[model samples]
Target: MLDWLRVVRMADMEAVRWALVGMSLDTVERAPVGVRAAQLWVSRMLQVGLIDRARPAFRQGSVVWPKDTTSGRVPDLFRQTARHDLAVSAVSARYLARGYEWRRDRRPITRRDHQADGVAILGGQAELVEVELTPKTPIRYKAIHSNHGERLTREGYTRVVYLATPGACRLAMKEADRWLFRDVRPRVVAAPVMDARGAWSGEPDAPWAENLMPPAPPDDAGTPALWEGIA
Candidate 1:
């Protein structure tokens, strides 16, 4: 069932005939060769119990179902599914492991009326996190920083981080060094791109059960620095 489901999902097979037709072929995108190849592959696997033989039902006769048995010589349907699933899991784990308090868009946080794209709780208050692919001009970045800074100060959130892609991050650093070192600057934290391949490349670490938010900023420029939230 799992194997059938996997193939069904990957190839969009609705019925046994479709599954059989999909697995054979000279090329998946073309016909005849594609259909025949699928039929042969499915039939051969069924004969070997690499797939299950379903009980005959009314109208439909007995059908071959792919079974995900852990054998060295087997179709990789289940293994492929598991690999795809694990990649997604690894990315999610990286986010949670980094002390982010994820909330859906428009979800309200107590004490602040502002809803966000996503937020991380800093100092017990939700600070909106904006993940960007492009770098904003210094004026634009400063404006964003100030808005978040003032809001966090007023609402008692310690700071907010703006996790940007590598290119944008470099621009942010440039602006930080040039303009933000003197005056009111929001604590913007940027991290590296978490690609699908890199998601599972890190050490597995458990997330913190609880996190503490720091006290509000005293002045406009007195915001605390940003840190990599991962422990």
Candidate 2:
């Protein structure tokens, strides 16, 4: 099943498994047809004891694998809200469309010491995509901006795009203005939060309303390619 889905690594498989938890078949069907076939693959996984499903109060049921199946730590399906899941789905869909490989980098950036949601790599460059459903306190935002502004170049990211709710995007843009005085290099662009259905309603040419500067030129070296090694 993993090979059929082109899930090359255990980590990527785990990511797909976690993202599918509490997500409906309709939502999964939004993925490109080849990937959307997860509907049937998931059923087979359940039969083979590769995954499990649990019903939670006040929410849809969730699919999860046994602790021993991958990471020993328990999955946090209970703590995840619908908005959070939608954000993940939205980003996943975007990366999937672009044919960028996904990595679940739960670790903090070495230079900034801030944990990004995940990293997507196409070829040479890596993009850090941050999904913000709710705005953080001013102090927290300041810290994030300060760290990212200082370390983006040193950390080797091509750019950092913040996908957040309209209100949160406004706050992020306001904070980005402060970077002008500091002379941050890596571009920061803010796009609207994806809908619950994981679709973007914004214009295709310019999805971002707030950008510290013009969007960076495409990384020609970072052209889309087949998925490769897993971290």
Error of 2 at 172 (Å): 1.0
RMSD of each: 17.6, 9.3
Error of 1 at 85 (Å): 18
lDDT of each: 0.41, 0.51
RMSD of 1: 17.6
Off-target runs (Cα >4 Å) in candidate 2 are 1-31, 34-36, 55-67, 70-74, 80-86, 109-112, 180-186, 195-215, 218-231
Cα lDDT, model 1, residue 17:
33
Give the C-alpha miss distance for residue 53 in model 2, angstroms. 2.6
Candidate 1 residue-wise lDDT, 73-138, digit = tens: 433334434333323222322333333333433544554343433545433555555544456788
lDDT of 2 by residue, 1-231 (tens): 333122212222323533443133343222334434555666677788665555445333343334245554544554555436545544654454444555655566465478766666766667677777777877777778776665565677666677766667767767766652333522666666454332344442342322311234433233111111101
Q: How many times do residue backbones clash in model 1?
A: 10
